[model samples]
Target: MNTVFVVGSLNIDQTIRVPSFPRAGETIRGSDATFSPGGKGANQAVAASRAGAAVRLVGRVGQDAHGAAILQVLAESNIDSSHVKLTDSASTGTAVIAVDDQGENQIILSPGANAALSFADVDAGLATLTPNDVLVLQLEIPRDIVRHAARAAKLCGAFVILNAAPSPLEIEGLFDDIDLLVVNEQEIQDLARLANASGDLAELTETLPSVLGPAVLCTAGAQGAVTFLGRRPVHISAPEVSVADTTAAGDTFVGYLAASLAADRELPAAMAIAGRAASIAVTRPGAVESIPWRHELPTLQDHDTQSAALFLSHP
Candidate 1:
């Protein structure tokens, strides 16, 4: 199978459970805080590795305990963390998250070393990518670096997939090199508006093939996802599951999707695995811990979309 390179962030997720979101200037009692390995880039890398892809993570972390923990998790998964550097320029990135009884969450990010990742530190590693490999990215890192990596990866003929989570103010510039664009409900609207594209979700999905030059997948929470993989748009349903935390559900989906595509699976098949993986993620807790493994997915071997309903509905 081809390799998957994840150029993203490393962070310590500090989460607390609250009865509900606090109002402006309001103080409320919350459950004891729990710390875990997180960061969109790191989470996606772990998910890809767990899904059976050989993953190499390229990012930065502070020379601190949080960084150590992040590295430990990568090693546990047998992911190549050599590209991840320990920088003293800033502390490790951190996220303060609060989840409610409904599994909805709000997060506040403090980008430290994550903001310090420079292309120079990862240039040599990125240069090793082959045309058959895949490069995955997110918005947690610098936009310029994300663009730079995308351009380089595209030029090498490698597949480039971007998960536009935590959508930025402008996304038109980043589309020049992306092979696949994955976004959620909010991100799709933000990106469409920023790109000066006037259309609803269906309209945008229909138009994105011409805009991004490849495929687009827009996830709709538990309802499933809408995909336009160079074909007409298809709405795929996610299996029913209990949601305990929505923290890294999107990241999990992106990771599995990238792995499937890199393995040369059909677009519909790739979309199916991603949705199924994300569905399983919602039923668990934690970020990295919540993602399902390849073995956990009973239908992982089904590469045709014809039987996707059978594979997804049963789980």
Candidate 2:
């Protein structure tokens, strides 16, 4: 199986449940705090491994208990964390999240060690990719590093999946060789605008694929996702499930999508696997904790005869 190299952030997430999001400058009472291993990088790595992908996590953490706890979570998920660096330069990254009763979340992140990721680390990670592997990245770390890594991965002939979350203002050159671009509704708009693509979801979606030459997936919570699979649009509805916390839903989707692709499944089948896994994720709390195990997913017999690996590179 192709390996999924997850290059991104590692964070200790602190979740507080409340009746609703607090108004600015308002001190609101909430439920007891819950801490878990999170960060988009870590969450996606966990999600990929749980979905049966051989995974490698490349990122940094501080020399602290929070970091150790996160490393333990990676080990528990069977993710290879050998490339994960431990530094005293800063405390482990942390995210303070508030999940309202409606399963909506708002997050505040302190980059900490995540901000310290350097080109050297990117080089070390790049050295591990092969044409048959997958390189997964996010914007949690420096945008420059994300851009650098994507470029290097392309040269190495690896398939790249960029989840443009918490979308940045100028993506500039992040899509140079990206095979798949995943984004939520807000991210899709931000990306389209950055690329100067105009129109509604359908029009916006088409314009991106034409410009970047990548399959675009725009995830719409509860309403499902709109994907440009096989150079056309396909809307996959998310299975309706009772909501708990929607923290890791998108991460779960991205991870599963990569895993399925690495397994040589077609895009439509991969999206189905991803959408179902994400539905299960939203019915739980915490980020990594919210992602479901592969065994927990229903058998996708309909996709059992996937034609080919639609988005993978081979040496």
Every candidate's CA RMSD: 3.4, 5.1
Candidate 2 per-residue lDDT over residues 1-315, each given as its tens digit:
699999999999999999999898988899999898999999999999999999998899999999999999999999999989998989999999999999999999999999999889888866868899888999899998888888889998988999987788786566877888998878888887788787666556656888767778877786677666555566666667899999989999999988988888877888889989999999998899999999999876664323222221111
Instruction: Give the Cα lDDT of each candidate.
Output: 0.85, 0.86
Off by over 4 Å in 2: 301-315
TM-score (C-alpha) between model 2 and the true structure: 0.93
For candidate 1, list the clashing residue pairs, or say none. none
User: What TM-score, computed on C-alpha atoms, does each candidate reach?
Assistant: 0.93, 0.93
Residue 299 shift from truth in candidate 1, angstroms: 2.9
Q: After superposition, how far is residue 92 of candidate 1 from its true place, in Å?
A: 0.7
Question: Where does candidate 1 stray beyond 4 Å?
Answer: 212-214, 300-315
For 60-126, candidate 1 gives per-residue lDDT tens digits of 9999999999999999988999999999989999999999999988999999998888878668669
